[model samples]
Target: MDLTVIWAFIIAFAVFAYVVMDGFDLGIGILFPTFAAGRERDRAMNSIAPVWDGNETWLVLGGGGLFAAFPLAYAVILPATYPLIIAMLLGLVFRGVAFEYRWRDPAHQKFWDMAFTGGSFVAALAQGMTLGALLQGIEVEGRAYAGSWWDWLTPYTLLTGLGTVAGYALLGSTWLIWKLDGEEQAHARKLAIRWGAATIVLMGAVSLYNISLNADYAARWLTAPEIYWVAPVPILTGIVAISMLRAILKERNSKPFWLGIALFFLGMSGLGVTIWPYAVPEALTIWDAAAPERSQIFMLVGVALTLPLIIGYTAWAYWVFRGKVADEGYH
Candidate 1:
């Protein structure tokens, strides 16, 4: 079997896990200001307090796996989007700090609240823009990133960034609906309906804009053979969107969050379809950018031993913390 393909899937799984796990918390942070202060804010924060930090483990795994198993891809992609990467890291740092300090420093809670919202917004935007930059294609000349520093900043990237923000907000609102009770849950349901509609609109916009960015992308989704495989993605996405809205409007607590997750899954699957086999999108195939086979084999063994443990503990944490959150508890 090809170890490169295995490692590629492993890294993709890690990234998908990171986005699914962390996206909601960042969404909560984005919706923080809209939530009422005091008990409402505390309940929102508490809903994620138990699992938020653990969610980042997938990010570390994804990044480290790329560096170890596909060092060439890492080297090329990083320089091409350094500004977005830096902003994302800084935003994560500030968000983490605020997450920890907001409760301890009540006197400065307002400041920390702003910091949390700003950090989450910045991080989510940078992530989406980075994705847009990659989708639009990077300039690679002789195994090096050849693009200008600001190449990542474009109208398409901005749309993608905003779309991601809306997507995350939808996730956050659904999460709140699942985790809060009474007034908070009702408020969250309302937010979920609005954000859900906005997210679907923006998702469509981003997909169309992505197609416009490259004829290859257009062909991938529109041409005969490829279109046959890709056609189900949007259809499924539409189905999920309808189901999710119905759940929200009906005031079902848990279904909206799980359905939101399905939407993200379908979106990522579409992305994989769009850029499969290519590590740098029209620049380098995964094989061309992979590390030595010996290195991947070595790392696969380590991952095999440790990944189960990570999954085991993460699942256990969620199981232990299951159910609605109260303002006075869990934080």
Candidate 2:
């Protein structure tokens, strides 16, 4: 196999890992407001506390992969989406501080918790904006950004931003159902049901809008017979989402969280498949943007050795932090 093809798969897998791992934590942060107080909110936070930092590793790997494998795409995307990137970084900072600070200052815990929620909302929004902007397609000339700054601030992009929030909130609520028990668990279930419904609506609207705007949707999604196999993912996602709603109503939290994750990942898979061969939507083909084969081969050698180590450490960390959080003071 060609090194370019191998690197392409690596990059794709890295991005997917980031989306699946950090996704739920982001969602849990977004879910902060609903639980309100006592064991419920704490349980929600505790559910992710064990692996939150490790989950973010995928982001680092994904970004690094892009910079190393598709330098041109990185150059264009970073500058064009600088504002959103800044917002995301800032949100992460606030979120990080909130996690520790909120626990330390028992006197003002509420404010810090709110800060965490707000930070999550901002980060999720920035990511969604970036995604929407990518879907809208940027102006690329000789591997550079040629579009105006205002081009990224469109209404459609804004809608995508909100969609991200809805999605994350849905993930968070589902997570709470899985890890928490008693009254907290029940509240989380309720929140999940409400937000899950809202997410389905928003996601559907975005899909319709994107299809309407992009004339190539038919070619990508509905053109050849191969698309028949692809169509079932979204259909299955809808079915699982409906089942999650029923599970929540029945006060079944654990399974709903995993199912919610499956639904979320299904949506992501649809987007990835729909935009295959194009790293930046319609802007650039993966082949055109891939790094040299020699460099990719070298990178592959490193990934082969390092990937297992990272995965092992991640599993260990989660195992150490497993089980519901007690009333013990936050360290």
Model 2 lDDT, residue 216, Cα? 79
Each prediction's whole-model lDDT (CA)? 0.93, 0.80
Question: Which tens-of-lDDT digit does each residue in 1-331 have in candidate 1?
Answer: 9999999999999999988899999999999999999999999999999999999999999999989999989999899899999999999999999999998899999999999999999999999998888888999999999989999999999998998899999999999999999999999999999999999999999888878888888999999998998899999999999999999999897999999999999998988888888999999999999999888889999999999999999999999999999657654
Off by over 4 Å in 2: none
Clashing pairs in 1: none
Measured with C-alpha atoms, the lDDT of residue 1 in candidate 2 is: 80
Tell me how candidate 1 scores on lDDT.
Answer: 0.93
Error of 2 at 32 (Å): 1.6
